[model samples]
Target: MLTFYSEGSRLRQARTELHDGALVTPFECPERLDLVLKQLRQSGLGEIRTPNAYGLAPVQAVHDKDYVTFLANCWTEWVSAGHKGEAIPNIWPARTLRGDRIPRAISGQLGYYALAAETSISEGTFEAAMASKDVALGAVEHTLKTGEPSFGLCRPPGHHAAYDQFGGYCFFNNAAIAAQRALDSGMGRVAILDVDFHHGNGTQQIFYQRDDVLFISLHGDPEVTFPYYSGYADEHGQGQGEGFNVNYPMPPGTSVATWMAALDQALARIHAAKCECLIVSLGVDIFVDDPISEFTFSSEDFTLLGKRLAHAGLPSVFLMEGGYAVEAIGVNVVNVLQGFKQSME
Candidate 1:
């Protein structure tokens, strides 16, 4: 299990975020990735390597070009506009609002391109996002070349981002971009299983209307969770993508038993799809102590989840996503990979 990482991920660290109407230190901080790396080294899972630059082309495959450009320039635009703090959205297009119209002002563009205000764009945001994107694509390339599994240590987790909107501390949809690159590289069929506590709304949106990639997520019920739209069980896909998208929305306080049951079902669906490769949006936020999430999974439960995923018998790419329990994140994440490696033996 090769781990792909970048020091550039530290660049997007925002000072604060608007949570519960009060500005507080962001839950998605660079320290989270640091802890994970520390654990990977302590465990000696595999060699840590810097990623090859895949550039914006692979990212553009799954994201809107204008949105990418906006991410690249938004920080400078915000600074030039005389804003001294991190750039957070003050407004968003709502019902009856014209979303099709692109705004010229930095303020309107911030609101237009941002899915929510929780993710504040800082100075190194675009740089960090590009680094994360390269990490994911590099893992995909490595997996293709070696026919082995690789882990993408992406920061500012990406499941909450959409094709054109950024949120949930994510700018570029790293997993979606990697899946797209895999398909383009001639992997016949790929299955993206998002085991994040939050539904992969962005990944779902990117592949919702397509059939080549099968997206499955097991997360908190969207009715009460963040990203309050589009994670319901009823959204099974549309048109050519019908029956390809699967969502298992479990209620809060769900136990590991219930979560693993959902994983079994998702794996079954993936196997039925004849998936040639697997992309796991590995999020440890489901841990019982995770600050912003509400699932009761114990650390051992993650090992169990990894064991089940290993049984899927497909080339896998594990991309880091959300997990606010900074203290235990590394242990929990490494538990999954270690368990998977042990199972293979």
Candidate 2:
């Protein structure tokens, strides 16, 4: 499988994120991708290349225009505002707060546009996030051209971002963007299978009212997971998208047996939907040792996970999302791909 990655991912590491009522270091760090790359190469996953740049149309397809403009220009505005460190959003529009106006001050706008402080815009964040998105888009392009599976080693993982909002260590929704690209290229029915430890609330929300794309996710149950809103089993699609979006939100301590069972159910639905292609939001954070996550899946389970997906017999594009167990992440990730290859054989 061809792998896509971006060196720009190293540019936007935050010093800390608010977690567990304390300011703690982030679990989704740049070194996670570095380690995954080393493992993929050593494991003979094939060569990886930098992404080719594309126009803003693909990005704009899923994200709001003003949000995209803000992402592109936030750091410049922050710098102009005399900010010295990273510009993390400190306030949010929740409950009775007024979200009616986009604030002129950078601080208020940051809160208005963002969901959490974990994802801050440093001087280089825009470029890094854009580059990461490019990597995913390039991988999607490769899959479209070759009809074979490819992996995008995207960092600053993007399943939490919405069309007009950013949070959960994400600024741009790369996986959603890739799905939109697939839809644009004549694939009327596409499926997004997110196996991240956390729910892909953003991806689900983007296509919730559309029937052209099918979004399915298997992740930690929202009652006990991060991005603590949405991700419930009852969040079936609405209107034109009814019965299209599926969420297999499992509880904590879920083992491979239960997880794959959920995967099988999701595959049944995908098959019923007659999806032409698949986009997997792959996150090794489900590994037992992932510091910030709660799932109990092991390295061997990932291989099993890949085999199950491959057995579904759809063309696939794997987008790297979250994985913090730096040592085992690559092995776990590559194991899924390798297992998929074996299944095909």
Candidate 3:
């Protein structure tokens, strides 16, 4: 399980996140990556390597060009507009408002492109996002080349982003970008299994109308979860992608047994799809102690989850997503990798 990481992730140092009604420190801070990296080194799971530069082409593949341009220039535009503090959206185009037009004002633009108000943009957000996608692309290359599992320790987790919208502490959809790269590299089919606490809305949106790539996610039910849209049991794929997209949305305090049952069903769907490659949107936020999410998974349960994915026997790429429990995130993440490695042995 080779791990791909980038020091550039340190540059995204936004200090504000809107939760409930007040601004507080972001749960998706840089320390999460530091702890995970430390555990990988101490556990001797595999070598931690810096990712190669893949540039914006791979990012543009899954994200809109204008959206990518907005992310790159958002911070600068906000600063130039004389706004104080990190860039956060206060307004959005709701159902009756005009969403087809792009706003000239930076504030309006922020709302126009943002899906939620929790994430803020700072000085180095664009650079760091670029590097994060590079890390994901590097893992895709490693998995394709070696036919072995690899991990992309991506910061600014990206499952919540869409083709043209950014939010949920994510600017660019790393897992979606990686899946597109895999398809571009001549693979017939690829399946993404998102075991994150929140639904992978962006990844599902990207492949929802396509049959070449299958998207599946098991997460907290959107009825009461963070992303309060999509992630329902009946929102199956449309047209050519019918029956390809799967969602197993469970309630809060979902037992490990129930979650594992959903995992078994997801795995069966993946196997039936005959996918040539597998990408796991790995998130440890489902841990019992996580601040922002609710689930009952323990550290040992993560190990079992990893082993189950390994048993599926497809070339795997693991992309890091949400996990705010700074103290135990390392152990839980490493447990998954170690379990997969040990299972392979």
Task: Tell me the tens digit of each residue's lDDT in model 3 across 1-345.
Answer: 799999998899989999989999999999998899999999988889999899888988888999999988888899899998999998999999998888899999999999999999988999989889989999999999889899999988889889999999999999999999999999999999999999988888888999999999999999999798879999899999999999999999999999999999899999999999999999999999999999999989999998998978999999999999999999999999988888988
lDDT of 2: 0.87
- After TM-score superposition, the amount by which residue 175's alpha carbon in candidate 1 deviates from its true location, in angstroms, is 0.6
Supply every candidate's count of residue pairs whose N, Cα or C atoms clash at under 3 angstroms: 0, 0, 0
Using all chains and alpha carbons, the TM-scores for the candidates as numbered come to: 0.99, 0.97, 0.99
Query: Model 1 reaches what TM-score against the true structure?
Result: 0.99
Q: After aligning candidate 3 to the native by TM-score, how far in Å is the CA of 124 from where it should be?
A: 0.6
Q: For model 1, what is the error of residue 138's alpha carbon versus the real structure, in angstroms, after optimal superposition? A: 1.5
lDDT of 3 at 233: 91
Candidate number achieving the greatest lDDT relative to the actual structure: 3
In candidate 2, stretches whose alpha carbon ends up further than 4 angstroms from where it belongs are none
Off by over 4 Å in 1: none
Task: Give the alpha carbon lDDT tens digit for every residue of 1-345 in model 1.
Answer: 899999988988789798999999999999998899999999999999999887889888988999999999999999999998889889888787988888999999999998888889888999999999889988888988887988999986788889999999888999999899889989877999999889999999999898999999999999999888879999989898999999999999998898898899999999999999999999999999999999998888888888899989988999999888999999999999988888877
Better of 1 and 2 by TM-score: 1
What is candidate 2's lDDT per residue for 148-220, written digit by digit as tens?
8999988778999899888888888999999988888999899999999899989988999999888999999
lDDT of 3: 0.92
